[model samples]
Target: MKINVEVDCTPEEARRAVGLPDLTPLHDKYVSMMMETMQGGVPPEMLETMMRSWAPMGEAGMAMWRKLFEGGAKS
Candidate 1:
Protein backbone atom coordinates (compact mmCIF):
# COMPACT_ATOMS: atom_id res chain seq x y z
CA MET A 1 0.00 0.00 0.00
CA LYS A 2 1.06 3.55 -0.66
CA ILE A 3 0.06 6.79 0.99
CA ASN A 4 0.00 10.16 -0.67
CA VAL A 5 -0.73 13.63 0.62
CA GLU A 6 -0.97 17.12 -0.81
CA VAL A 7 0.43 19.60 1.63
CA ASP A 8 -1.22 22.97 1.07
CA CYS A 9 -1.15 24.29 4.56
CA THR A 10 0.44 27.52 5.79
CA PRO A 11 3.15 27.43 8.42
CA GLU A 12 0.68 28.29 11.12
CA GLU A 13 -1.57 25.41 10.08
CA ALA A 14 1.29 22.98 9.90
CA ARG A 15 2.39 24.06 13.35
CA ARG A 16 -1.12 23.75 14.71
CA ALA A 17 -1.60 20.36 13.13
CA VAL A 18 1.22 19.09 15.30
CA GLY A 19 0.21 21.36 18.19
CA LEU A 20 2.37 24.49 17.78
CA PRO A 21 1.88 28.22 17.89
CA ASP A 22 2.72 30.94 15.40
CA LEU A 23 6.32 32.11 15.48
CA THR A 24 6.16 34.96 13.00
CA PRO A 25 6.87 37.56 15.62
CA LEU A 26 10.04 35.81 16.66
CA HIS A 27 11.19 35.55 13.05
CA ASP A 28 10.31 39.17 12.48
CA LYS A 29 12.62 40.17 15.28
CA TYR A 30 15.49 38.23 13.77
CA VAL A 31 14.95 39.83 10.41
CA SER A 32 14.78 43.22 12.06
CA MET A 33 18.11 42.66 13.76
CA MET A 34 19.69 41.41 10.55
CA MET A 35 18.51 44.44 8.67
CA GLU A 36 19.70 46.67 11.45
CA THR A 37 23.08 45.04 11.35
CA MET A 38 23.31 45.75 7.67
CA GLN A 39 22.07 49.28 7.97
CA GLY A 40 24.36 49.91 10.90
CA GLY A 41 27.31 48.75 8.80
CA VAL A 42 28.28 45.70 10.78
CA PRO A 43 31.13 43.60 9.39
CA PRO A 44 30.34 40.56 7.20
CA GLU A 45 31.85 37.97 9.53
CA MET A 46 30.06 39.39 12.53
CA LEU A 47 26.74 39.53 10.69
CA GLU A 48 27.02 35.93 9.56
CA THR A 49 27.74 34.74 13.08
CA MET A 50 24.94 36.83 14.50
CA MET A 51 22.49 35.39 11.98
CA ARG A 52 23.54 31.84 12.69
CA SER A 53 23.42 32.42 16.42
CA TRP A 54 19.98 33.96 16.18
CA ALA A 55 18.66 31.15 14.00
CA PRO A 56 15.44 29.57 15.18
CA MET A 57 15.33 26.21 16.95
CA GLY A 58 13.51 24.01 14.37
CA GLU A 59 11.89 23.74 10.96
CA ALA A 60 9.77 26.79 11.54
CA GLY A 61 12.83 28.84 12.33
CA MET A 62 14.60 27.59 9.25
CA ALA A 63 11.65 28.42 7.06
CA MET A 64 11.47 31.89 8.52
CA TRP A 65 15.16 32.40 7.96
CA ARG A 66 14.87 31.41 4.33
CA LYS A 67 12.01 33.78 3.78
CA LEU A 68 13.83 36.56 5.55
CA PHE A 69 16.96 36.09 3.48
CA GLU A 70 15.01 35.93 0.26
CA GLY A 71 13.31 39.19 1.04
CA GLY A 72 16.48 40.75 2.30
CA ALA A 73 18.33 39.80 -0.83
CA LYS A 74 15.72 41.48 -3.00
CA SER A 75 15.90 44.72 -1.05
Candidate 2:
Protein backbone atom coordinates (compact mmCIF):
# COMPACT_ATOMS: atom_id res chain seq x y z
CA MET A 1 0.00 0.00 0.00
CA LYS A 2 1.09 3.52 -0.78
CA ILE A 3 -0.07 6.78 0.63
CA ASN A 4 0.14 10.27 -0.82
CA VAL A 5 2.00 13.05 0.96
CA GLU A 6 0.92 16.60 0.44
CA VAL A 7 2.69 19.77 1.43
CA ASP A 8 0.75 23.02 1.60
CA CYS A 9 2.33 26.06 3.14
CA THR A 10 4.41 29.16 2.61
CA PRO A 11 8.19 28.94 2.07
CA GLU A 12 8.83 29.95 5.66
CA GLU A 13 6.50 27.24 6.98
CA ALA A 14 8.07 24.60 4.78
CA ARG A 15 11.55 25.55 5.96
CA ARG A 16 10.45 25.46 9.60
CA ALA A 17 8.75 22.07 9.15
CA VAL A 18 12.06 20.63 7.96
CA GLY A 19 13.91 22.17 10.94
CA LEU A 20 15.83 24.48 8.63
CA PRO A 21 16.62 27.82 10.15
CA ASP A 22 16.18 30.96 8.11
CA LEU A 23 19.51 31.82 6.46
CA THR A 24 18.96 35.33 5.25
CA PRO A 25 22.18 36.62 6.83
CA LEU A 26 24.21 33.75 5.41
CA HIS A 27 22.73 34.27 1.99
CA ASP A 28 23.44 37.96 2.17
CA LYS A 29 27.03 37.34 3.16
CA TYR A 30 27.48 34.85 0.32
CA VAL A 31 26.10 37.30 -2.19
CA SER A 32 28.31 40.07 -0.90
CA MET A 33 31.41 37.90 -1.16
CA MET A 34 30.51 36.74 -4.65
CA MET A 35 30.00 40.30 -5.77
CA GLU A 36 33.31 41.34 -4.27
CA THR A 37 35.10 38.51 -6.02
CA MET A 38 33.44 39.16 -9.35
CA GLN A 39 34.28 42.89 -9.20
CA GLY A 40 31.80 43.85 -11.90
CA GLY A 41 29.02 41.46 -10.87
CA VAL A 42 28.87 37.69 -11.37
CA PRO A 43 26.94 35.86 -14.02
CA PRO A 44 24.74 32.83 -13.25
CA GLU A 45 26.92 30.57 -15.42
CA MET A 46 30.06 31.49 -13.52
CA LEU A 47 28.26 30.88 -10.22
CA GLU A 48 27.17 27.42 -11.40
CA THR A 49 30.71 26.60 -12.49
CA MET A 50 32.08 27.70 -9.13
CA MET A 51 29.59 25.54 -7.23
CA ARG A 52 30.22 22.49 -9.40
CA SER A 53 33.99 22.80 -9.09
CA TRP A 54 33.87 23.01 -5.30
CA ALA A 55 31.20 20.32 -4.79
CA PRO A 56 33.56 17.37 -5.24
CA MET A 57 36.36 17.27 -2.67
CA GLY A 58 37.56 15.36 0.40
CA GLU A 59 37.21 16.31 4.07
CA ALA A 60 40.34 18.41 4.21
CA GLY A 61 39.22 20.35 1.18
CA MET A 62 35.79 20.73 2.73
CA ALA A 63 37.23 22.17 5.92
CA MET A 64 39.26 24.61 3.88
CA TRP A 65 36.18 25.41 1.87
CA ARG A 66 34.20 26.05 5.07
CA LYS A 67 36.93 28.28 6.41
CA LEU A 68 36.78 30.35 3.25
CA PHE A 69 33.01 30.18 3.35
CA GLU A 70 32.85 31.58 6.87
CA GLY A 71 34.98 34.52 5.70
CA GLY A 72 38.67 34.06 4.90
CA ALA A 73 41.09 31.46 6.22
CA LYS A 74 42.53 31.78 9.73
CA SER A 75 46.22 32.44 9.94
Q: TM-score for each prediction?
A: 0.51, 0.47
Candidate 1 residue lDDT tens string, 1-70: 9999899998778899999878889999987986677788766577556556667676566567668766
Best by lDDT: 1
* Model 2 poorest ten-residue lDDT run: 66-75
Native-referenced Cα lDDT, model 2: 0.72
Q: Residue 71 of model 1: what lDDT?
A: 95
Q: Please, what are the lDDT tens digits per residue for candidate 2 over residues 1-75?
A: 999999789999989999999998999999888768766655657755676577676666656655664473243
What does candidate 2 score on TM? 0.47
The alpha-carbon root-mean-square deviation between model 2 and the true structure, to one decimal in Å, is 11.1
- Candidate topping TM-score: 1
After superposing candidate 1 on the true structure, give the runs of residues whose Cα lies further than 4 Å from its correct spot.
5-7, 48-75
